[model samples]
Target: MSDIVLLNKHQKKALVIELYNQGKTRRQIAETVHMSFKDMADIINEYTGEDKQVNKPEKSKDSRAFELFLQGKQSVEVAIELDMPADKVEELHVQYWRLSKLDNLEILYHEAEYSLSLLLRLHNILKDKRITKDKDISDLIELANWFTRS
Candidate 1:
């Protein structure tokens, strides 16, 4: 097998700029440029100065809610675990549940029709319930279901 030809730092920097402009992520650019992800990151940092700033990862309330949901826990459990509002937990759970279903299902065209009916039903129910409830949870659930169906 032949040895891999690596680009110099200047070339890497130029490539990183091009890739960033094209909306490719640091990791993706690193792979495409045939460099170690860390090396590519360093070059990008030198060029863009984006790495100098420290940023915290946005902790996902949805992930925590999903874990609780899998363990047979509900909104209250999620709220307690994540120290968020019960309503927020419900929102996250609905979102996570919908995404999970979409990821697992190998949906066909026919299922889309069935899914639309389900979404419309949820939408109407939520619309009606909105009159009585301050927090209309049906809307959240309906949106989630709609995305999954699509």
Candidate 2:
């Protein structure tokens, strides 16, 4: 099995352009990146500044359903529009919601890591100061404890 590469929007666009430049067909690149052909073409056009006609393929039903849901369409409405089961529309909505939550959590995790590094640097800078003796830095200790417990 091939390992999945997780990329943010900018990175994904860059990758798509790079792959396209390397002579990969749009269909090939789209399938490789798991993006709709229309979306891939749009990215390429945005990057290259060419008014390319986007191929409106019918293969991105899940994405279309999710797009409708995000546009304030209910599950039943999306199902009717997409000619899919309401349950399937609901399932796709839930899946997209979970993925978004995971993305947010990943961002929070990176922020927490950055904060810890900053805290450590600050602690090192203040290590030689007599202020450490006056102030217990109890919050830092508590943070360390929490990390260890987790």
Candidate 3:
């Protein structure tokens, strides 16, 4: 617990990868990493050579969207550039962000980019323990309050 609490983002990912390599179940790894099980499963699936995205008719569009996302383009920008529907691009954006492992970093960037203390608080939340779905929502709501108040 103390070990994980002190680890930075890359260390956490490396730990998750290490756990996966050692044949830990997705649920086990997620608990160890304090991440949501679904997010953990997605990371594991991608790491284990399973295609997270499949059977979409717009395969090339997804690929292009991934490229655009990698270039740091937001979803709206990608949608416009690719002439894609907003809803579809929105879905793709979530997938892309998860696939790219930009989860907490993106949130931190948008929510507290200039505030080291806020960033640390967000970091502490993930670092401390596995958060349940409802608890996660509560923490996010609290964080949003902090953002809005500033």
Q: Relative to the true structure, how large is the alpha-carbon lDDT of every model?
A: 0.71, 0.78, 0.80
lDDT of 3 at 5: 59
Which ranges of candidate 3 are over 4 A from the true structure?
1-4, 55-150
What are the runs in model 2 whose C-alpha is more than 4 Å off? 52-150
Which is better, 1 or 3, measured by TM-score?
3
Clashes per model (N, Cα, C within 3 A): 0, 0, 0
Candidate 2 collision pairs: none
Kindly list the per-residue Cα lDDT of model 1 for residues 1-150, writing each as its tens digit: 877777787877788889978999877887878788777777767776675556657657666668778888867767887899866775666566667685333243236646867767766986776634644575666878999999
| Model 2: ten consecutive residues of lowest lDDT | 101-110
Model 1 residue-pair collision total: 0
Error of 3 at 125 (Å): 73
Over 1-150, each residue of candidate 3 has an lDDT whose tens digit, in order, gives 354356677787788889999989877888788888777777677787888566446659889999999999988899899999998997788777778897976565557657968767766886676654777869878998999999
Better of 1 and 2 by TM-score: 2
Which candidate tops lDDT? 3
Better of 2 and 3 by lDDT: 3
Query: Using lDDT as the measure, what is the rank order of every candidate, best first?
Result: 3, 2, 1
* Tens-place lDDT digits, model 2, residues 9-70: 88888889999999999988988888888889889888888855445556599988868867
